[model samples]
Target: MAFQCQRDCYMKEFVTTVVSCCPAELKHEVNGKKETLKGFNVKLQDTILFPEGGGQPDDHGLIADVPVIRVTRQGPEAIHFVASPLAVGQEVQVKVNWERRFDHMQQHSGQHLLTALADTMFGFKTTSWDLGRQRSVIELDTPCMKPAQLQGLEEAVNEKIRAHVPVTVQLLSIDDPAVEKVRSRGLPEDHAGPIRIIDIEGIDANMCCGTHVSNLSHLQVIKLLGIEKGKKNKTNLIFLAGNRVLKYAEKSYSTERAMVSILKTGPDEHVEAVDKLQKSVKLLQKTNLSLLRDMAVLIAKNFENNPQKGNFFSLHKKEGDNEFMNIIANEINTEETLVFLTVGEDKGPGLFLLAGPSRSVAEMGPWVLKMLKGKGAGKNGRFQGKANSLAQRAEVEVFLQQHCKHQTSEEE
Candidate 1:
């Protein structure tokens, strides 16, 4: 779909429209399945579906019971992407998705109210805004925001929502005197069209191009979630409105309940419980490491008396730490003793360490690594690597024993 199409229709329809159409194939993925939608790009005399623009998403609905998946504005005309093709010059019933439309209206109008309130109550100007599906955001020109200030602004905005302030729209030429009175982010550099001003009773009047509810009451409610740090000094305020706020609250409550049950604590004690549990875990890990170190010292003393056993040592265990293995090596004569150790619980790619006289150390790692189909690094008679399979442990031990004996005989 090109943006520069010139066959534009300017008449904007509110409810239904007779439209001419042309067949267009759309290839896209749905739910991870690629499929082709046999549809037509229908150009109507007018359309109720608002085309995506100005940070707001496009409206979706059916055109004569066939789903209109997408709508885009090509120049002045509203292009409806319908499921099946319609004959050229055929008049079709176009129904707007009122539920989705109303939701957008609530969110967009709620944003204007919130933005205006922020500006008036705290002197923060709205830099930009986005209308999302679940929530909306407004970027405020401020370095930081106080929690108390946010609470105050939220309370003030809800008060206006309860006031049921009437929202009015006015279209004025750029040169009109009243245009000067409207609050706008700024006029676009290429803008030549008349300004569309949205007025919220006595609260505010700002120039905007998006759809909005006619009354503040229609917003149901406005919630300021929080602020996110934005570029340099700007703050982006997250918010939700109407049904979305209720939905978010419901999901949050459900998640909190799950967390409480899993933590085995009530909501009031969850934070304290988690902190205490973390401290206990740290203490237990420290104790376990001390035990492993004691075991390493005992094993190393046994090797000191019987250096022959340590000369060609190979130990493969279900769970061992590299630090524990290195501690054992530190107690042995690393210049003469060759040590091959491996550790794993129940899987491939297990941790391994090899150390001995330089010649033996270099030969041991490459042969054992090849047998296990793994990789490693070594220097100064110490090599650390990973084994791909536990089944190769026996083969690695036999190969090391034979090579060590051959190397010993050659030295004699």
Candidate 2:
């Protein structure tokens, strides 16, 4: 009889304890299934892994040396999936990443603080919450709030954080008499089974399903991002907590440092420096326009001296936009002459403008616009079009000259 290896049999029985330890090692089997460790099983002995529920992300860390790849809620229990397999009934030390856990705790507690403050100060109740990686948002029942009112509420929450109030977590059954003391404006009495209530001594007491820190001091700092009007009768508040606040501060400092270097000013003068740069830009733009106008005057004088005899005089120059060409056309239009000015590259894109003191140019304006494949309207003997190329400008000029002559002949 050939001896057979029990690898397949052993693989089926692999298990890791879930809730017996503080940081339980979760054994998982990988066979090309769900990514990010989802759908994996856990052997929790009354697990405390906060599942992804109640607008809070599941706690993440290593379990029994293997990474607790993902924690998700299925029904009631928080299931933790791990990477490597473990022996059934094997005792392994568990380790939870306290930093990640603590950050979540701060955010969760900060939310409670804010919600409690909202209810007490402004008669508003938090309806929902979204805990993001960088920011946390709480949606309130009231849709609108003045900036001054939001500022006051933020100041009040920060004061509580500074006070270092203890946050006590109590687990109670639905029938427990103490459950009556747990008052939340949003939660219904018959909503669920056993409920967990978080109490901030003398400040707040509310029913919550998320994990929180032991005290308000753990939150360290709470920064309000803003409050915006949301869907009917709901106001959304964005905030930052714990290390997120520090991270924001670090990023802001980096931005200020870069701005200081670019603006060539000290930290104190950064605002003033930016203001000065804006004013300088405006003055430079005005000076440039004045110079363009002077150049247009010069070009018109030269055109007058070397007049192109005909009903239409055409000129094309390398210019920025229609502004310069329009200026030159207006200067020449003062005389009883019709001018078709097209300014830009002959091989590339350009602008077209026709200003003349004749009804022929005005009548032929629509035809020229169509020939150039550009858009504009003419009224009171002035027309303009955005030309695709300087070649199109020449085409338009020829079309205008022929049309004007034809119309003059017809009138005669």
Candidate 3:
């Protein structure tokens, strides 16, 4: 009822007197805390700020110097959520955030122009649309479009913008004959009022409630970014309108400059230079892998012939990884001997591995990980895990030695 009253009373005026001000019925969250924000749900006789509706975001601005954070339609009233309470029955100066409002106008209107031309020239009806902050998209019913067709569609839309066609609006009875000429998916089932229609000269006439620019010239330009496959065999067309086009261009140019500096190559040679560097890195990686395998073989042999020391065979490599430790574990797991190998230096924590008969491997796996403040799992006769604090590695070695001694005593 409030939304209906406001819409009916003010129609589409930009500024008006405040009808009333009261506390908002809802609460909101600010920052990380839940606090009751002082919301002034002020209703104006007529205002320019669009309430959030019809897929377009609400306009934000100030009402008599108080920040208007949000706007919503309740029944017939457009409720303005203000920073602080305002006095009822007072005149307020309402200023729309023109930059944002104009940007939406450009994008929304550009979408209409593109959709109309696509339907007319290509028979690709728009299924849905989204007006994003940085870009806009129109999902077409058709599955795809050729590059040449996309290029032509873009040219046609801009041609209309240059032609400066007038975009006019009319409020007509739903039963009016002119309504028959308007293209739409049809009105809401409960709809019972005059239908608003937007006409772009001879190009398009469609039913809509969203705001738009008065003329195509205001759009400045429309640039199609590209298209992608969408839901249910649809194609999504991505584009930017007005200031967003310039913003995107500036961002792209800045990124290219940064890339050129980092790569130390001219723009034309950047691709070739990157490709060569990537190939070289790949070859070097292969060489390193071969060397690591050789090192693992040599390390395993050294420990193999040292003769049994107690029931455990333990070795710690200052520079070792999961792969290297695994290779050593495979080489030295024999005679039921518990092979405990650790690779890493005092520089940081390292990989810790324990491989032996199934029973010992299972027992020491969890114990070593817990003692070293790490975690891992294993099965069969192999167990490998990481050590977060290798400062405790010597302690682990002592524990393993003691465990081996205990087993020998029991056997004897």
Candidate 4:
């Protein structure tokens, strides 16, 4: 038997079937395919299941010692799929996982309470609802609500929960003339079957397909997590209820405690402690730069006194950092003499070399690099590149002797 609801609401009916019994083992074949079993192709008249529809997840539990893997709606009936296929004419005692079911119910009911509150207190209507794992969100017709106003709405919802108002479900034929009396935003009015309407005592009444609790008290608590702007003057709000609210509270407390311990300060001073640490880092950077300048000056003085007696002179040294190396290179390049300065870590040869003006050093730069199995190019009497080995210093000196002679003979 089917009847349409005047209000366009949906009510879930609990029905029990009585039939002759046989032992049926629930079989789960859908899990192998990693797909949610939509319908169980079984012959049984002894089970009642909540099917997957209306944004509600499937119900799972044991039916006569066989695991009911999933429940889904096929046509107009709810079918229960088990872990093992059930034989024809088998009797099974069906049980639903009350914990999961109740959690879903709380979330659904909380959504209605919040939506109704938004309509009554602020003239904001709920356009849609999405019941998700861990949290649920509702979209309102208004674009934004002040934080203080949302907090008030949360307080008002929890007050209704504390009052423990009864929730009533009513079924009405869709073709009934009274259907126009109950106003709603999202439900389609011309549907075929009876519509279910859930009423929260004096608080709210709405059209919804999801399962819900019998009273507001089952929600235990209602917390508004946050609100954000949605498309076209709409607002999305996230919320938590019952056990979810408790879990969030516990997690927040643990985070604050850890922060206090790390900062070695009370809750109020943690932010200030982080600010002080940032300032200390900035001061240390300035001190390091000043020390680098002093070290570069001392290295340049040493290079002036110990010039090599040749047209080409190259000095390789371990410097404090790359910035100090560039500073020393700039100082050496100012003089008219020919010199090459290479700086690197002490573990191996330098990766960067800078050459000053001298014909023999400029010519030997590429030839000596080629002898060391490295490649480089230069113009305007300066060259720089990587050296393959620290031992290549001897090869560099010998190459300078050979190349400087050719330059000296040309000058003569």
Candidate 5:
């Protein structure tokens, strides 16, 4: 038996009696996070909310003033998932979200028309299709389509829309001979009663169980957006239909306006403006690197002039990076001198490097890493890695000074 939703796709509201209501929970795992939806699985004598199936999402609505989160099909029954329970024998009014339902109808019917024309005109069979939140996709059996072919296909779909072709639903018995003549992908295992076929006037007839508009004119227009490479050597054609096309246009215009204001350029010059800005940024970055290298040489020279004051030198620069520290170390002669360099906030996490005597560096590198909550390795008297905390930097400098002093005393 066809559910009331299938019987009248246009119906937005209906009065019905609740057959059963039981507690249920739906869980979804997303990015390792578990989200559980607590609700009641409600079975109604008949409903206006279409259950999810046939590549179409379920309709969200209200039953007895309670919000319906989802609807699913079980055999011939449509189960409504609601946040609140309803009395079994109570007569309640069910309301469907008409705006969402109508939008889906437009896109679903548009897919049927596009699929039929592609198969007939270009011999492209639709392997599958998806009705997304903002746009829909139809994956064809072919690997790709030429630009001209795509343009022609889109034009043909809109032409049929302009022709105002009527879309009708037909039900056929499982054993009917005429059923063999129509297109189908086999009935569901739990499918019962007559098979439902969506016939697009004289264009084509295919088995489907989703809600659709009564006429192609209801589609308003179909815009083929673009194509993406699909898995299994298929070509996925992306498209927007009905109000979605208008929504896309509005969003695009708004973005253009914002860019024009920011770039101080007309819509036509946005690409050139962005390209010039990117080039300017790259040049600035290159010049900054050269200046940093020159500054590193100067810093090492100043330290060499006063090497007798302290063999251990410590410096921290917020703007200096790991490469900058390496440049300074290379310029400084460190046969007897040990230098500790850090780049980042004075008391927060950053980077640290130690370069000096081979034995001292090797022994102190792991100690520095542990004290700063970091990890690093030393080779040829240079140890550096990321530090999670620089709060103990002053204490680390004092310890290094004592070690150098102890070494000097032993040498005497």
Candidate 6:
């Protein structure tokens, strides 16, 4: 059963009687995000809005001035989900969003033109397609499309639109001989009506249920963006048609202007400028690492020169990393002096390291790490890993001092 919108694509308003209105919850997606709409499913005597089917989105409009969120086909009926309920047998005005509906018509018809041209001119068959909010995609059976082939196909499609060819819809009985000649993927199991054939004059005829423009000229113009890899051995051709082409051009110009300001270069040189900037950053990182290593060696030499100060040495550097801490530990003999080092904020999360007499480090490393709300391991005379808190730094130092005194007494 075809809705009024399909019969006459230009129809925007219809007067219909409400057959039934029942509570319904629709779960659907918008811009890749899932949304739930709680409303009433309304069945009308007939609808001017097309339901979602045949790869086209549902029409959104008003049913008796109440916002209609979605319309879906259940068997042969178009069920409208409206924000408010209408009493059964009531007469209401159902209006289509002319702007949105016309956009869909232009795109759907544009796809038909592209598919038909690709088949004859390039020998690439369209396996599937999707009509997105901003752009549309057509999956070709081939693995890829070359620039020349794409340019040829785009030119051929625009030629047809320039010719102002007529687009007409014909409803044929299921048993009609012409039904077998038209292109089709087959019909739904619950479909209970005549077959729909969309004929583009001498171009092609395909079976479809989506709304479309009456003439190819209504498509305005089409722009082929590019191609993307598809599942298995397929190529997806991305395109924009009609009003979408204008929208794309506006956004692209704005982006180019912004990049010109930030890059301090024209659009033609922006890519080369960004490439050079990336190379410079990599060079600076290497120079910084070399400087950090030199600083680490110097700090260790000062500690070694003052041996009479104490056997225990502790230090913290806010911007230091594991490599910096390890360098200091290696410069001094942990067997002679206990070394405790940390990096990052004194009272916040950071890393810690302990290198000293094997027995002392092994006995004390685990508990010290636990007190800082962390977990690590000690092997030989070194313990290191991440710690969540360093607020208990004072207490940990006192514990290490007492442990060092006990070992000294035992040695005496």
- Against the true structure, whose TM-score is highest? 5
Give the Cα lDDT of each candidate.
Answer: 0.78, 0.71, 0.81, 0.66, 0.90, 0.90
Candidate 2 residue-wise lDDT, 193-296, digit = tens: 55767889998877776677788888888899898777877889999988889999999999999998898888899989888989999999999888888898
N/CA/C clash count, model 4: 18
* Whole-structure CA lDDT of model 4: 0.66
TM-score of each model, paired residue for residue:
0.75, 0.59, 0.80, 0.60, 0.88, 0.80
The predicted structure with the larger TM-score, 3 or 5, is 5
Model 4 weakest lDDT span, ten residues long: 1-10
**lDDT by residue for model 6 over 30-78, one digit each (tens)?**
8899999788999999999899988899898998899888899999999
Clashes of 5: 0
Total clashing residue pairs per candidate? Answer: 0, 9, 12, 18, 0, 0
Report the C-alpha lDDT of model 4 over 212-330, residue by residue, as the tens digit.
77888888999899988788999999999888899889998898899898988998897899899889888887787778777777666666566654444455666545566556666
**lDDT tens string, model 5, 1-412?**
6888778999988999999999999774568899898889999999889998888998989998899988999999998888888999999999999989998898899999999999998999998899998999999999989999999999999999999999999999989888898877778899999989899999989899999999999999999999999999999999999999999999999999999999999999999999999999999999998888889888998888873746778888887788899988887777788889998888898999999989989999999999889877889999999999999998898898899889889998
Better of 1 and 6 by TM-score: 6
Cα lDDT, model 3, residue 122:
97
lDDT of 1 by residue, 1-412 (tens): 1111111111122434546778888776799998998878887676667777656677777666777888876665678887787666656666667678777777888888988889999999988898886779999999999999999998998898898899987778888999888888786464545677889999999887667778888888888999999887999999998888888889999988998889988888988998999999999999988998888778777877873573677776675788888988888787888888888854466888888899878766777778777788888899887777767777778888888888888888
Question: Which clashing pairs does model 1 show?
Answer: none
lDDT at residue 266 of model 5 (Cα atoms)? 99
Task: Sort all candidates by lDDT, best to worst.
Answer: 5, 6, 3, 1, 2, 4
Candidate 4 runs further than 4 Å off: 1-49, 64-70, 81-83, 183-193, 275-412
Error of 2 at 47 (Å): 3.3
